[model samples]
Target: MQELEKKEFERLLPYLYKRKERCPTFVFAVLERFIPGFVFADDLNSPKTIFVGTDSGLYFVGGPISNVAFNKHFLKFCSSKLKEGRRFTLFSGSGGWDGLISDCFRLELKQSSRYSFTFHPEEYGVKEVQLQEPFTVSRLDEATIRSSHEFNLEYYERFWGSAGHFLDKGFGYSVIDGETALAGECTSIFRGKVYAEIDIYVDAEYRGMGVAKKAAQAFIDHCLKNEMIPCWDCNVENLASRKLADRLGFREPSSYSIFVKNQ
Candidate 1:
């Protein structure tokens, strides 16, 4: 067993690039952004086969974590000891990724289960589409943070929750009326200097209002000002999500499939 540090994960930079041109893996991008890649490493026993991410938490994608493997001190060092809240995955592996990470918590699995959307800045252009009266979008700030109301914890926990963290990191904008979040988006993360991601969410009552698409473009513009790229991705079967991504000029960058276990 081997150990890795948060800042030392950049050694896995090559894998980040390999996955970037395709779908952007959320965890890979998050760790890469939050820490250096030298700290990230492939499990030597697993080789070019499996990989793991270490930080305030430990996430695995390459191999099955047998009791011995998960308990090893080396593994202990990278994986999170606090098993309370939850962690998330952006975009990731193929048909077999779930089998490879059976030891990961159900929460982590829930976070990674969604298909990723990758949107490009050059492909995104916004017209001055006005919103319905009594609604407006403002920059996210301390006040805005307090003003925003999230409707669902589970959806936010997995998808929107990750976006919220990223929003707190960089520039984010929200659409609201009287403190209600009709829809919102943030400049989540960068895949190299060339690409960025727009994480958007719309309230159930506010669907079809273009709140998601417009707010998403605002975040994309913000990414451009910061010298990054952005994209949106969604599952093919998700008609609404796919339509929203398409409205914002995002297309499927690669193939993706979803998995779930009926425990």
Candidate 2:
């Protein structure tokens, strides 16, 4: 795929019809602030379809790209990128690339609903549980971030990359067990105004202990205090996550699909 230069990127914005999501938008925000080598690309003619790829995944943005020729180019470009081993997942709103990619690759096309829930602390009622012994839930700051990096570099790298950036732009809460970070609830993606999407990471050993819920509560409280609304999203089949959202007073789950690339 041909990369779009700054001017080309800006000029193409008005013509693009991207899906409304905070995560990918957060990538764009990070690109603007850090210039972290993020790439944006699209077809040459009409340029109806486009995407932005980061370390985490590929985000398909813009258009009713029904053109056959463009789809083929898009496929070739993505396959090449996949071989390069940077982006691991494909997230699209409308381009029908899921089907196109499946037709060419052996990857499994798993279907799941994307759930978006709203936050209302008052509705949480008595379900809120404070962290007790063996667990300390607190706002994740620079110090904790460093400790986490030192604790487990390989596993925490996903959550640790650009930690400072996210901490500055939004907020995060971590469940610490003495020295180890057991679980965390952080603002994964945000639009810098009224919305921030929540992403949680709980160590396998700490699952089902209400650690995620506690950390999430801390994050939700921060958002409410700051006049920002917190959003929780996940695959519908993720029952535990759905339950956690329910516990945090999030209502009205929604659905969407993201294509995960298999190795």
Where is model 2 poorest over a 10-residue stretch in terms of lDDT? Answer: 149-158
Residue-level lDDT of model 2, residues 126-191, one tens digit each, is 466766676777776667667663333332334335555556665677888876655554544443
Task: Give the lDDT of residue 135 in candidate 1.
Answer: 79
- Reference-based TM-score of each model: 0.64, 0.70
Q: Give the top-scoring candidate (lDDT).
A: 2
Model 1 regions more than 4 Å off: 19-25, 33-40, 43-50, 53-92, 96-114, 120-122, 151-168, 178-196, 257-263
Quickly count the clashes in candidate 1: 28
The TM-score that candidate 2 achieves is 0.70
Where does the lowest 10-residue lDDT sum fall in candidate 1?
A: 35-44
lDDT of 2 at 98: 49
Instruction: For candidate 1, write residues 130-189 as lDDT tens digits.
Output: 887677877765555554465233333343334455354445677876555446545343
